[model samples]
Every structure is written in C-alpha cells, then in structure tokens.
Target: MNKEEANQTQAGKEQKAPKEMDANDLPKVTAFQDEATREYMVSTKEVEPGYYLLESKSKKIRMLFPEEGKYSDLLSNFSKNEEIIGFDEYDKEANILMNGQITYYQGQSFLRKTDTMIEIISGKNKYSEEYQKENKDNTEISIGYKKSNFDNLDRKNNYSYRYFGFVKPNQSLDEGVEYSFIFTCKDDNQSCSLDEKIARDKVKKMISSIQFSCNKEE
Candidate 1:
C-alpha cells in the first residue's frame, strides 16, 4: 500500500478505538492513613501486600514490631510472628462484631499486655476436620468472600473462617500463624436471622477486598 493510504487507515483505526471500561468494573478502593497506621479498602479487590480488609462503620489497625525476637512490619504482617495491633469493632446495642481476630498471639508478651481485645471467640478444634476432609484433593489455597463459608464448628449464629495462613515477609514458612476470623450476632434467643446473615456477608465482602502497605514515614 502507498504511504499516504497507510496513514489514512491508521488514523481511521485510532478514531474507532474502544470505549473505556466503567470505574465500577475496576473495583473501588479507599485509603485510610492514621498517625501510626495506614491501610486501603476495596469494594471488590483486596487492598494488598496482605490478604484482606474488613468493612465496618469504624476502621482502625495498628502495626507494631517488638524490639525482641520475631517482629512484623506494617507492610507485611499477615500472620507473621511479629506483633500486630488490630481490633474488631462492635455494635453494642445490636451485639454485632464487625470483624473477629483469628490470630491468638502477637508473639510478644509485653506487647500483648498493653493491647486489650474488644472481643475474643474460641473454638474447640484448631481446624475443621470436615472441611479439611472435603477439600483434601484441592491443593490450591481458597480465598473467601461473602459467598465463601468455612467451618463454624457448630456454633449457633456464628460465621467463622480462617485468614490466608501466615505469610512471612520473605514468603517462607517458619511457623504457620494461620489465624481464623468470625462474624456473629448476639440476639435475645441467640439465633441469626436473614438480616444477620446478610450483615455478615457484607462484612465478608469487605474482608475479601482488604489490602495494605507500610507507611515508612516517621
């Protein structure tokens, strides 16, 4: 083809370029920065470097590194031995907890003394036998959202699950800090209705899309 004809054809193709995708399709995320902590939340994607973030009316997470043995930084503290300071917000009147802490230890005794928990839920088994047996063939790890339901361990009105197992900063496993997360509503009769189920699902969706990074600034 002639140079002039090729130029014209290229111009025509440029004019016919595809339309831009909607912002909704990309997953909307909001960033949160506090004096000692910073995090991000996505409507559809985890705010990342870590696994997930929980959606709640109130959001706060504290990252800490003990001067002693194993430590965790803000940028990479999923289930590491390092001490992390995070809490679950609760609606006292409704008796609803926004996100439950699955990790039982912060790796430092002194730090744990200063950090108090709002709520702590315990289970009988470390991992659900039924769930492990059912998905024995699946080697790939499963990340859950509102639709993903793990073992509740026969707890009435409780939605329980495990966070992505402890991922070290170097991405090597020394000790698995695989923690669990839970959502439950406290009612007069101790039963979860459709409303409670829906509420938990919303929180789960928030958790699935949660991600974070370190704020290195002093």
Candidate 2:
C-alpha cells in the first residue's frame, strides 16, 4: 500500500474506533434520585434509641435507618458495589432493573417487577441476554419471597436481594412521572442473603413509615 493510503486507512480506523466512556458520564451515587435529594433534606430525630428517621426534601416520605452500627455505615454510603446492602430510587425511564415483566417503554425493553414483594433470587445467569429474552413476554411471573423456596436455575444458590415498589399515585396513575424504589444488595453478598429476616424487617418499617402529602389531603 502507498504511504498516503496507509495514513488514510489509519485515520479511518481511528474514526471508527469507539471512544471509551468518561468517568463523569458514568452513573454516580448522586444519579440516584432519592440519595441526591437527601443532600438538601433536614435530618430528623431518631425514631428510637438505635434508629434515626430519614426524610426526603421534596417528596413527602420518611424512613428509619440504624443510627450507629455496621448496617448504618453500609447504608450511608451510596456507592454501588457488591458488599453493601442499600436502597436506591430512580426515574422509571432509567430501566436498569431486572427479573419480572418485560415491557417496552419508549421502545426500549424494561424488566419491571410489577409485584410489591421482596425476594431473594439467584444472580446466576440473571444478566444473560438469553434469560432476559426467554422471560420477555412472561407477565404472570413475579419476584416474591417464599420460605426456603430458592428458584436457582443452575442449582447454585448465589442469591441477590430485590424489593421493587412504585410510588403511591395521587389521583390518576398518569398524572405525573412515576419513580420506583429498588431495595437491593446490589450483588450476591452471602451476608446479605443470610440476613433476610433483618433486612425484611427494616425494609418493612421503612415502607410502612412512608406517608404521602396527597393522601393526607384526601
């Protein structure tokens, strides 16, 4: 090949090469709507000696978390990783959820948990594209907890936690943009998997405490 032709080929390859994703473009902890709003919120007094009440600044919502303990520290850090047991809220448009009804929103397939139940599911092959496609049209399936009922597809109980809940609607469901709550272990943590009772208790308390302003007016 000629020198000029070689130079042109190199330039074409460079142009076609995909750019690496910038760190800033990546989803940070603040990308979570609830965690971001907590920055501007007023810290409420402890609900009890060991638990403190957490409130959202804009949303009429409140929950309790451990005041001082290992769990407290873990929950405080909003960074996404495998070890931490934390909850996150984001706009439904950001379809990063898994395991449930596969529906299309804005022409993109989203795996949404229609049931308001907490369950421990196998992380094995959960991210496989084939698994997703298999359950794409399965709406009757739900992510609900059953005692000693582990649905490990590969017979490996490498479990992850998930509790998906939708915000309470004011009047009509179509009145406003809806947000979903994802209380998860983020990945397969053995400790998180075994601590189901404690996690379920705490999450139940938090969800029960949630009170909407619109509901109060009605």
Candidate 3:
C-alpha cells in the first residue's frame, strides 16, 4: 500500500482514551482513601449492583459482602493490636448480632483463649464440638455454639444463642492477625431462630471470602 493509505488505516484503528471517572459516579463502598496523602488505600470492583470485590492495602484484608448495607463500622481507630466491627438486625422484636475482632499478638492463637472464656462463662462442655474447615488459601476456621442464660428482666435484652468462630491465617512475618467472630440472637421466638440462621449464613459467606496478604502502603 502507499504511505498515505497506510497512514490513513493506522489513524482509523487508533481509539480515544477512556474518560476519567467522576467521584460522584463511584459506588459508596468502592474505595477508601488515605487522609494523609489523599491516595486510595482500599479499592473495590463492582461485581453487581450493591456487591463488590473489595481489597485493602492498610488492613491486609479482602472480603466481599453482598449485604454490605446491613453492617455498621464499630471501630473507627484502626489498630494493629486490636480492632472490632459488627452488624445487627432487629425484626419482630428479635435481635440478631454479629461481630468480629482482630488481635495481633505475635505467635499467639486466639482460639484457645476464646475457648477458655466460653468454658468459664458457660461451664465446661457447654459449647458444641467444633466444626472445622481448612481453606485452600491456608486459612483455618472452626465454628461452635453455646447457649447463654442471662439474668435480665427484659427479654429483648437477653442474649441466648452464642456462635463463635476462630480464623487462623497463613503464617509469615507480620502474618495474620488472630480473628474471632461472634454471632448471637435472642431465643425469644421462631422468627429469632430464622434470623439467626440467615445471619449465620451471611457470616459464613463473609468468612469464606476473607484473604490476608502482605499488602503494604508505600
């Protein structure tokens, strides 16, 4: 082909650069920025409306929750030593609560500590045998349940169903933080049990998606 024809063909094949996204167009849970440098520390890809694939550089954590609107951030001051987060629901006077705690204690395991606490509070062998699962990414999870009878006059305030979960992440320097998740509900009615099961399933889904890495901010 002649040089003029070749040039015209090449120009025709060239595409325009995509437009930059406006902050207003982004999803609410899509990304979190660092206050210091105004840089993005956490980002997420929208899998579908209201669902995202979230990744965090600061926390070294990644998880996707479809029911993200239901959760509330309990801890604002994030720390390496300890942090807590939770979500709760009240329907038909049934209260269902789920919370997770992460603790960094070098080589210590939080599983034994939680087990001891459960035994002390509920008596020995009060909790059911652990249901354990090992994920392919080197995360280990153990689940168990215990019933608690609190001396409270208000039935709404009485906590009955106690579910505990221990997560052990893959080991390394500054490895995984010890994680514990507690799910609870009032044993007041059949609606409570149904909500408890639904919340429990959501917890499982959230835990299964968790991944810890050595991601660090520059």
- State which candidate has the highest lDDT: 3
User: Using TM-score as the measure, what is the rank order of every candidate, best first?
Assistant: 3, 2, 1
Superior by lDDT: candidate 1 or candidate 3: 3
Candidate 2 lDDT by residue in tens digits, 134-190: 111111222223223246655344444443332232332221111222233333322
Name model 1 segments beyond 4 Å from true. Answer: 1-80, 91-95, 102-128, 132-171, 175-177, 187-218
lDDT head-to-head 1 vs 2, winner: 2
**What range of 10 consecutive residues in model 2 has the weakest lDDT sum?**
129-138
lDDT, candidate 3, residue 21?
34
RMSD list, candidates in order? 14.5, 19.3, 8.9
lDDT tens digits, residue span 54-117, model 1: 3211222222211111111332334444433344444455555444332323344332321111
Judged by whole-model lDDT over C-alpha atoms, candidate 3 comes out at 0.46
The model with the greatest TM-score is 3
Measured with C-alpha atoms, the lDDT of residue 215 in candidate 3 is: 33
Residue 217 lDDT (model 1): 28
Against the hidden reference, what TM-scores do the models get? 0.31, 0.35, 0.52
Tell me the deviation in Å of residue 15 in model 1: 37
Model 1 residue 174 distance off true place after TM-score fit, in angstroms: 3.1
